[model samples]
Target: MFSKACEYAIRSLIYVTEKSKNGERVSVTDISTAVESPFAFTGKTLQKLVKQDIISSAKGPNGGFYITEEQAKANRLADVVSLIDGNAVFQGCGLGLKICKENQPCPLHQNFKEIRKQLKKMLQSTTVAELAESQATQKTFLNNINRN
Candidate 1:
């Protein structure tokens, strides 16, 4: 239902958010080891997140990636999602039919249309700071998806 890269990106962002209050600037190696992801690939995605200003970063010793309080407030879940996954998640019809629309509804269209709209709205509304606080306090587990 979701891309692994997108999932990793968000999870990593949340991890950054959780550590931000402590001013933890973690290295790529540390982040991947902590997040249980591939170092090189996740590093590239983190680079994009930094370039996009969805997260903050630095280079060299005692410098790496760390979210700021401002960055936590600035970034929305949809922004991270769009950065990693493009516009497809918000654009596609939920029904299997390619032509499912208001004029031509599929069986699953009605069921999906409302939820998809709600999901998009929720994603648009929430931020990493909000999500991180909740996720950190709870017994959260990372989920894996089949990659293409």
Candidate 2:
């Protein structure tokens, strides 16, 4: 599971990419609504993503957040996860043990380790462009609402 911030970051980035792929900029309000996140929280998350260079933004009458073609092609879900949540999901103890490890294994350590490896692989293999493409092609929906 991802942190709330991470969830918003992923959703917002995907939404931005969906709009930006055609050279359109996305506003914070629009991004928050599209992603179903709080306006202020989404704004803060976007700022962090901008700082990390995971996305880009500008200020003015025609300014908003947009992803460059190179950025969209290069970024993976794991990159966003790492930038927002560090390696906590991949490295933290599954059972919340203070010092769980392979040597001093927790009850769920071995099983959880395998799960983590699979998750890391999936995230690494999934790029922002792929996600945006899936959405654009109507293969996926970012929000729970029925568009129809």
Candidate 3:
């Protein structure tokens, strides 16, 4: 599982991917509404993402969050997760051991190792643009995290 911040980051990512087209941008309020994320918390998450270059933003009247062409293409879910959560979610022991290891395997090591690996692959392999393109017509699950 991921933290609220991580979830907010992912959802905000969905908002940016859906609304911005490499150059286009939207206000924080729009992003909050689209992603059903809290303003203060999501804003904090966005600020960190901006610092990490996982996302981009601008100030002033016409300024807002947007992504670059290279960023649009290169930004993966893994990067966002790493920015917001580092490797905490994926690196922890699946069996909740005090300090499980290869020599001292957890009870569920054999069962969960492969699944965690697959999840990582899924997250790291999926790009923001890819997810946006896939959800072009249907509901944007990532973007519509907010109810309104």
Q: Which candidate number has the best lDDT?
A: 2
Candidate 3 lDDT score relative to the true structure: 0.78
Instruction: Give a tens-digit lDDT track for model 2, residues 1-148.
Output: 8999999999999999989988899899999998899999999999988998889998999899999978888999999999889999999999888999879999999999999999999999999999999998878999767456
How far residue 13's Cα lies from its native spot in candidate 3, in Å, is: 0.8
By lDDT, the better pick of 2 and 3 is 2
Q: Model 3: which ten-residue window has the lowest total lDDT? A: 139-148
Error of 1 at 93 (Å): 2.5
| Model 1 lDDT per residue over 49-112, tens place | 9999988888787898999888898889999888898876776677546787778888777778
Residue clash pairs of candidate 3: 34-143, 35-145, 35-146, 36-145, 36-146
Consecutive 10-residue window with the lowest summed lDDT within model 2: 139-148
> Distance (Å) between predicted and true CA of 41, model 2?
1.0
Worst window of 10 by summed lDDT in candidate 1: 139-148
Report the Cα lDDT for residue 44, model 2.
93
Give RMSD (Å) of candidate 3 vs. truth: 2.7
Ranking by lDDT: 2, 1, 3
Judged by TM-score, which candidate is best? 2
